[model samples]
Structure formats: structure tokens, C-alpha cells
Target: MDSPATLEHYKAGMLLSGAGDSTGFKRELNYSGPDIHEAKKQLGGLKNITVKLPDWSVSDDTDLHLATAEALATGKKGEELLQEVALHYVEGMKDMTGREPGGSTIMGASMLKPGTEGGYRIPYNPESGGCGAAMRTMFIGLSPATLEHYKAGMLLSGAGDAIGFKWEFNYSGPDIHEAVKQLGGLKNITVKLPDWSVSDDTVLHLATAEALATGKKGEELLQEVAFRYVEGMKDMTGREPGGSTIMGASMLKPGTEGGYRIPYNPRSGGCGAAMRTMCIGLRYPRPEQLSSLVAVAVETGRMTHPHPTGFLGGLASALFTAYAVQRRPITEWGLGLVKEACPAAKEFVKTAGYAVEETERDWGYFTEKWEWYLELRGLSSGTGPVVWPDPYGPAERDKAYESFSWSGWGGSSGHDAPMIALDALLGAGSNWEELMNRVAFHGGDSDSTAVIACCCWGLLYGTEGVPPGNYSNLEYRDRLENSAEELYKLSH
Candidate 1:
């Protein structure tokens, strides 16, 4: 594993670079000719002068640092690096307060303009050797290999979800039978047993991968792709899709006026929403893009779960997954990101007619309840007691489960399942087997929680960390691998 300190140092260095730029510009303001000095002198020799500071924001140096970091994280190199940096550079300029960048930085960035015919060349300006470029190169010192490893880890997570679903819940429904029939008979299956089959989670993930591969923007495209998958599932199996799929399929049905905005069941808050959000998180690379990411996640969730809790559950899952894939220190920043994304989640929930008072209280209560549950589970941070003395042995777990649902099926609720999955991931530490075991055996929607938890485990540790036995028996193993590869390609 790469040292967290090293990542933190690079982050701190970038911030320091920005601070240096701010200080340098501010100091220069202090020496703005004798006329300014005279004007200050006329103000009664005020030694303690308060001047309105310039924006004091980071400059193109920080901009280049961020862009380069993203490029490196996504495995861009040579011409790819140049193109990515060029695009990010323009985006950085547009993001700037006044749409201006340092002349040298702009010149170097402009060399890789769109439609420019270039094989591969260093984007440097001989005329300009400003400190901007040199100072921001600290991030480049971090190994690209580490980022690649993280990507592999994320893909493995997707695999874990799909395969884990198969291993734990075998095929019992018409959906599984149809899938098996479509892919030759059980006799043709070599690695997979007849009973092993994937769920809507994997199907929806592949749907997302196909959509992203076509270069479509997230929101509408992802939702459409998800609906198509749901519709396909409905067509294949002459049964109403269970859990959140029922609501999603209903919403996707042609409405009274030839539209797709049919009202869905707001009461549905199943784990399905969170289970399928990993693909969305993998597509968008930055936190600044969180709003759009959350938007798409909500739309995807709206297919089945229009409730605020449902949307927030999906958003939270994607945020955590994205942060994990980016190699953010989970123990340090995971909970913080969840908290940061909560306001947006609440607002999304509010749109579902969740009372304002209830929205605020629910989020606050959920956080508190989650923390309390973690404490009870003997988890201090992202690591904890490896083997929880069977949760069923103690009445406390039963009571907690009942608090969420009367049927002891807490994992059926979108909010509850994600919380449980997050808890499982945090407490599992590096023990992938333990994570899988705990989630799979937790009972009541265990399959859903297993998928979510296993996905998180994969994000933290690559496929190498997962036991081969877990995925080897999956019927759609090849498809899962292909989907993961496609998602990885598009993400990069």
C-alpha cells in the first residue's frame, strides 16, 4: 500500500503552492509605488493599515497541479497526458474568477489545443521558465502505478458485488433462469455451477458501462440505460421486478401523454439504489463534480426510489465508492465526505415531499444512529473486531434490526442497507473474507448488503485481495470482467 502520509504531503504541497501564490501577490501589493505610500501617509501615519486584499486565490500553478493530478490518476500519458492537460487547462481557465491565467502557463497549455496535430511532445515554452510549472510538479512525483492499482481495486469491487451476489444467493427467480437460458444451457457452463447467477446490480452496472462507453453525459443517459435494463428484465421474466426495480420499471413505463415521467412509489427505499451507484462514481473523477454525480445518481435512484432517503442512500454510496477508488484515506476522510455530501442528499430528499423538519431530523438521526451502531459493533474507525460474536446471539442486533423494519429486514431499506454496508466495510479493515462473511450472513436482505460491502472491500483492496472461490462460480463471470474492463477504460 502507498503511504497515506505521502498522499497527504502532496496535497499539502499543492495547498502550500496556492498559499505562496496568494502571499506573493499580496506582498507585491504592499510595494505599489510611492504614490500609494503617500496616500497611506496622508491617512494619519496608520501603521496598522487594512487594505482590501486581492482575491488571493490560487493561480494557474494550483490549476495545473489539479489537472495533472487528475490526469495521472486516470492513467493518461504522453499524447494522452497532453490532451487531458490541455482540456483541463482550458477548464481551469474557465473556472477562474476572471478567465485569465499566467502568460507562460497559458502558452504551454495552448500548444495542445483541440484539433492540433501532434504525436507526442513536451508542452513547454522555452521563453517562459516561470516557477508555476516547477512548483506544481510535486504531485507528478507520486507514482502513476499507485493510481492504476486503485483503478484495479475499483474494478475488483464491481466484480465483488456481482460475484458475491451470485455466490450468496444462487438463482431462484425467473430472471436467473432466463439469464442462464440466454447464455447457452447449464450444461455449457464450465466454471459456473447451475445455481449461481447475478442480480439486477450487475445487470445495471453493465448497462451503465455500455452507456458510458458511448461517450454520453451521465444524468439522462444513465437513467435511460438503467430503464432499458429494467425493461429488458421485465420482458424476459413475466414478473413484476422486486424491491426498487418495481418502482423503477413503473416510472419508466410510457405515461398518459407519451412521456416517461410517471410517478413512482416514494415509499420504496430499497438497497437497489445504492447497489447500482458504483458505476456513476467511477465515471466522474473529482469532488467538484459531486453535484452532477449526485444528480445522475438521484435520477437512477428515481427509477425505483423517489424518496429522499432513497436518493441520499444512492448518493452516499457513490460518494464513498468514488472517494475510495480515488485512493482517499478511508479511515481519515470517509466519514467526513459522507457528512459533507449529506446536505445535498437532504435537499434531494426534500424534493420527494419529505417534510423539511423530517429531512433535517432524519439525516441527523441517521448519522447519530450510525455512530452508535458502530460503537456497539466495537468499531472505532475503519478497523475493528474481526469476528463479531454472531449478531444473532446478542439481542441487541435483533433490536437494532427491528428498529429499522418490523420484519428484521433492515437491509431492505435503502438508508439502512448503505449504513450497514459502510459499517461492514469500515470494520472489515483489510480482511476481505471477514467483510464478505459478515455481510453475507447478516440475514434479511443479506445479499444486498453483501453486494454493497463487497464492492467497498474491492475498492480498498484489488481483486487479489478477494478470495478466488467467491467469484469463480459466477455464471456471468466473463461479462463481469468485460464490464469492469470497459468501465476502467472509460474512466481513464
Candidate 2:
């Protein structure tokens, strides 16, 4: 066997690896065979090759390799070492102008955290079979290894809740823009408290999340969720909790002989149910968990808003969250969701002994709403150039939403809450600022709509574009992150 590698050997290996990367990048050598032979033959002999600095640049793989080496040189261990490596990898993304970084590498690096256990590596991704990992890790013989999207979803949902909650009581309609101007313009809005305290939306969402994180399933999970909802009501000071939710939770009897769910209430169709169900999707995100998602979402929804319109909105939010976590196309996120999940939702209503007749009758209301939304966005025909339209101004938004049969009160009811939120998400594309402007500064129940929208956005794009001040000091941030981490562990 050969002798162990010395300092000079390591140096030589790193330099050569970087040089190889630069040469391969410059040659555009992703594949091999006669094509490479022809290109090399056309270039003549090695005497003509003049690989120099600045001109022949290495790819992001080499940059990340250097980062990894620096991380290893820090003399840290365990979580500290992992944190150092994550920081270096993320910082390396700043100046990758022509580096040709792998998309998976960027995504994985963007999501790395600092302290939590098992937070070093990203979760399994079947499609991430790129050479980025191998190229960057060539120098290291051994090392360590996330559901970062779900975690971001959880955290940013609270951020959206806080910001939107501030606007709920402060501004309405066209005046919200002026309010935004008063708060040092849109970009200057600090996401810290007491200006941006999270309301009942996040509290109830956390209750659902913490309950799901307990790893209970079926009736046990539902019971725990109901218990938490009831318990959550005790600390509603300054939360501005909704009356519908308060009344609904007050009547719940968890661990009782019958069940934790209340009877179907035709009168209740508020946004309360939809706002808190984002965590349900995070808990059950796999294709196999569709039934579980349907059950949990519908059951938890019925716990408060038992009407089909209300409960179905909860199902929609959860389903959309799952779709976002799966990285499904944004265009498909709206109409495709209604097509896919409606059947499962209907089946759950029938088998779960809900008011089947009422659900069958009122379910069309929710379905038609989505269909109308798709039609409005020019997504219903499937033949047209389907682009998620730009976000409408407040007046235009409310004017269009008036046709949804909700008296122009956008996002007031459960059906329209998730709908408006989804519209914001689609329109905003990858822009966090645009997402907040569309969903959080809207007319009715902005906080409720924002909670769902931000969760889906976070799942699709892990808070990369969101300003740090927006979420760094968000209330209950620790609880939200921990809850997300637990749910991510369960899902992954």
C-alpha cells in the first residue's frame, strides 16, 4: 500500500482538482466519447493549451470544495463543524457569476442551518443526481450529512401572520398602500414586534403543528389536536382571536366517548379553519400520505368550521402545502390541486361519517370557486399561454374577487381565504416581497390568507428571498422552527 498523504500531497491534490475543474468547464466537457475526441483534436496538441487564472475559471464545485476544506480546517466537531461547513457553503454563493453552479447544490446550500440536530444535510431528493456532491467532496474521504423547505414554510408562515395581522386592524382596501408608505415604504417594514406581533392565526397553527409533531396518528392525533386547540384559547391576550374559532374550540370534548369533532355547522364558513391547517400538510407530505392528509385536514377543519365550504378550504391549504413541498409546477398548483384533492376530500367526507349530504351539496361551492379562480387567471382552458398573472392592485383585486359570491370581502370566508392566498402565491412567483404585498395587505382576513400563502411559498422557495428582519425576530419563532423541524423529521 502507499504511504499516508502529507500536507504537500493534500495541497497538490486540491490544486490539481481545481485545475481539472477549470479545464473541464472551459472545454464544456460534461460527457465523453468521440465528441470529446473531435473537440480535443480540433484544438490540436497540449502545447497550444494555456490555462491561466481569471480567464479559465473553475465551476462552483471547486468553490464549494474550497469552502469544505476551510470548514474542515476550523478544528470544530459535531454540530459546530457542520454549522461551519454550512455557513461556508452558503457564503460561497455570493459571487457565482459564471461558475455554473448546480441547482441542487444551490438549493441545498441555501437551506443549511446552524444549531439544530440533524440540520446539517438536506433531505433526500431523488432528482438531485448531479455531480456537485462528488466534485465538491473529492478531497474528503468521510464526513456528515434536511426538509428545509418544510421548516421555512413553518417559519415564514408565522412571519406572514405577524405582518398581515398588523394590517388586519390597521388598514383596509386602497388605504393599505398609504399605511405601507407610512411604515417607511414596503421594503422598510420591519418584521419585529410589537409592530408585527403574530395573531391567533399563528397560535392555532402552532397548536396543530405541535400536536402533529407528537407523532400520533388517526383518532389519537385528532384528539391531541382538539385538546391543543382548546388549550390554545386560554392564552388569547392581544392575539385578537377569532370568535368563531373561540366558540368552536370551547365546545370541544377531547378524549370523550364519541369524538372530538363538533357537529356540522352550516352557518360557520369563516377563514379560521383554513389559516391553521398549513402544518397538516407538512406532517403528511408524501403521495402515500394523501389519505392521511385528507383525513387530518378535514377532521381538524371540522373541529371548528364544520361546513363543507370551511373544512374544504382547510383541505385546500394542506393539499397546496404538500404540492409545494413536492416541488410541483406552480401553474399546476391551483387547478391541478382542485382536480386531484377534491375526489379524496369527498371520499373522506363520505367514509368519515360527516354530514355527507351537506358536503355533497356545499362541496360544489368550493370546487366552483377554484374553477372560477382558474378561469379568472386564464388557466381553465389549458390551450392558452398559461402564465400566473401579475398581482392586482387592491381595488382591482377586490373588484375581481367580488364575483366569487362572497360580497367582495376577499378572504373573509374559509373558501376564499385559501383561494386568495393561493392566488397571491401564484402571482408572486419567487418574490417574497410581492407575496406579502399581495396576500398580507389585502382587504379581508389578510392574516388568515397570508398564513396559508406564505407557508406554500416557503415550501417551494425556502425563505431565500425573504428579508432576514422579516423573520429573525418573529414572535414564537423558536416554537415554529422546532415544530417544523419535528414535522420534517417525521416526513423525511
- Residue-by-residue lDDT tens digits, candidate 2, 1-492: 122244566688899998888877875644766777677677785556667878788888789999988998887877788888888888888859899898898888777764667668888889889988788777566321136777789999999898888778643657786788787866676788777788899999999999999999888999999999999898788988876788789889989944677776787788888999998888877666788899999899989888878888888888888777665556676665687777888888889876888778777778888888788777775333454435568777756555553656778787888878877877788898888878888667778889999999888888787878889888899999999999988976
Give me candidate 1's TM-score against the actual structure. 0.57
- List model 1 lDDT by residue over 343-379, tens digit each: 5656655674534464455445445555555555554
Alpha-carbon lDDT, every model: 0.56, 0.80
Model 1 residue runs over 4 Å out of place are 1-191, 235-241, 253-261, 332-334, 347-407
Q: Give the local distance difference test score of model 2.
A: 0.80
TM-score for all predictions?
0.57, 0.70
Misplaced by over 4 Å in model 2 are 1-145, 381-384, 387-391
